[model samples]
Target: MGGSATRSAAREVILTLVVAAILIAAMPLLIGTYTLTVLVIYGMLGLSLGLIWGFGGILCFGQAAFFGLGAYIYAISAVNIGESTLPMILAVLLTAGFALLLGAMMFYGRLTDVYLGVITLVVTLILFKFINSTAGPQYVIGEARLGGFNGIPGFQTLNVPGDPGAYIWGDALYYVCAVALVIVFLLVTWLLRSSFGRIAVGIRENETRMALMGYDVAARKTVLFAIGAAIAGLAGALFASWAEIVTPTLFSLGQSAEIIIWCIVGGLGTRLGPVVGAAGLAYLEFVLGQQSMIDNTLIMGLVLVIFVLFLPRGLVPAIASLWQGSVGAFGRRRPVRRMRRARHG
Candidate 1:
C-alpha cells in the first residue's frame, strides 16, 4: 500500500507538471493579450493566497487592504517620480510596513484564529469603504491628484535598465508577473520546508502544544501575517501595472472572500492548489458570465455548494484521485503479478 501510494503520488505530481507546461507553452498562441493578462493576474493573486492560507495558516481577511495599498502606492509613486520601478519598490516597502504595523497590533494582542480573522476582515472593509468614499479628496503628490474613486490610470510602463530595443511593455508585464509568481512560489515552498515554516504548521495543527514547547506562537503568527501581507501587496502592485487601473474595489470584502474561496476550492494547504483554483475560477467566470440566464447566478452558487459538499478536500485532492480512479477505471483488471510487472517493468 505504501508503494502504491507513493507511485500514485508521483504520477499525480508528474501530471501536474505536464499540465502546467502544456498550459504555458500553449498560452502565447492560444490566448489573446487580454486573456493572458487576466491569467497572469489570477496566478499572482492566487500565489498570494497560497502563501498565506496554504502555508502560513493565516486566514487573513484584510489582505485586500495591502493589495489596494500596493496599487495606490505604485500609482501614487509612479505619478510622483515618473518612474515605474521606483513605484514598485515604494509600494512593496510601504505595504510591508503597513502589514507589519497591523500584525503587531492584532497578533501582539493575542488575537488569533477566529478573532484574528474578524479583526482583519473589519480592517479590510474599513479600508475599502474609506477608499471608496475618498477617491478624489486629493492630496497633491508632486502635482498629481489621486483621483480617488476614479483611482489612477495611464501609468508609465516599466523601464528595464540598459535595454536597447523597443519593448511591448504589456507582454513584458505578463512575463514579469509570471516570473514573479514562479519565484514567490519557490520561496514559499522552500520556507515551508524550513524549521520556521514547520513551526507554523505546528501552530496550525496544535498551537497550544507548540506554545508549551516554548515557542512564541503569537510572534510567529505575527511574522507570518506580515510576510503574507507583503506578498499580497506585491500582487496588488502587479495587478495595477497589468490592468493600468486602481480601484477601491481592490480592497473590498468581495476580494477578500474570493481569495478565501480560491484557497479553499484549490486545496488550501498545497502550493499550486490556490493558483490553479484562481485560474480555474477566472476561466469559469469569463466563460459562464457571457450568458445572461435567469438562473445563471443560481447555477454558479449551486456549483460552489456542490464542490464544498461532495468534495471537501478540493480540486487538488480531486486531481490526486485521478491516479487511483484510473486504476479503477480499468475495472477488474489484471492479476497482481501482471499489474506489478506492467507498473514497474
Candidate 2:
C-alpha cells in the first residue's frame, strides 16, 4: 500500500508538471510577458511560505528578510563579479545559510509559535531599517553600493550560463521564471511525499507526540525552515533580475504581510493554494494600479476577510470539495437511474 501510494503521488506530480509546461508554453499568447513574470515570481514567493507554514507549521513573518537579502546579495555579487550565474547561486546559498542559523537559534532555544513569529517579524524589521540606513558611501560591499532606499540598479541581469553577454529579458525571462516555478513546485510536491516531509508534517500536527516518538523535532523544523528560505531566496533573485533593482522595500512589513495574505487567501496546507492566491491577487492589484479608484491594500484586506469568514479552507480546497461533491452526486444519481430502469424493464 505504501509503495502504491508513493507511485500514485509520483504520477500526480508528473501530470501536474505536464499541465504546467503546457501553460508555460501557451501563457505568453494570452498575457504580457512582464505581468506574467511578476506573477510567476510572486507565486514562487507564496510557495516558499506555503512550504513552511502550511506543511511544516512554521509561521515565519520574516520571509521578506530572506527575499530582500537574496536580491541584495545577487545584486552586490553581480556588480562585483560582472556575471549573474555565480551571483544567483550565492543569493540562494547565503540566504539559506542565514535562515539555517536563525532557525537553529529559534528552534533549539525552544521558542513557542507566538515568540517565533515575533522574532521573525523583528528580524525582518531590523533588516529593513538597516538597509534603509545604508545611504552613505561607506555602505559598500566590494564595488556595489547599498544605495539605501534608492536601491541597487544597473546590475547585470540573468544571462546564459558561461556567457554574460546573452542577457535574459522580456519573454525569455518569463519563460525562465515559469520553468523555475514549475521545477520548484514539483520539488516541493516530491518533498511532501518523502519520509522527512511526512515527519515535518507530523511535527507540525503534534510536536509533543513527534518528540515523544523519538524524532528530533527541533532539527527537522530548522532544516525545513532553511529549505523554505532557500526557495524564497531564489524567487527574490528572479525578481531582482526582472526588475533590475534591489531595494530595502523588499524587507518591509507590508511585503511580509502580503506574503502571508497570499497563503491565507489561496488556502493553507495545499501546495497550489499559495501560488494561485499570489497570482490572482497580484494580477488584481496590477489592474487596480492602473486605476486610482480602488485602494489595493483595502481590496486585499476585504478579500482576506471574506475568505476567512466564508471560505476559510481557501479557494483551492473549497473548489476541490465542490468538485468532489458534484462528481459524487452524479455517481449516486446514475445508480438510482440504473435501478429505475431495471424495475421498469
Off by over 4 Å in 2: 329-345
Global local distance difference test of model 2: 0.89
lDDT of each residue in 1-345, candidate 1, tens digit only? 979866775675566557756766678786665677667667667767667666666788777788888888888776677667777788888888888888889877877679988988888888777766765555457655666577778775455643313333666766667667766766675566557877877787677899999999888877787777777778887788777788888888877767776777887667777788887777777777787774555654676687789876678756755654687864344444222321221
Which candidate number would show the highest TM-score if scored against the true structure?
Answer: 2
- Lowest-scoring 10 consecutive residues by lDDT in candidate 2? 336-345
- In angstroms, give how far residue 321 of model 1 lies from its true place: 3.9
Cα lDDT over the full model 1: 0.72
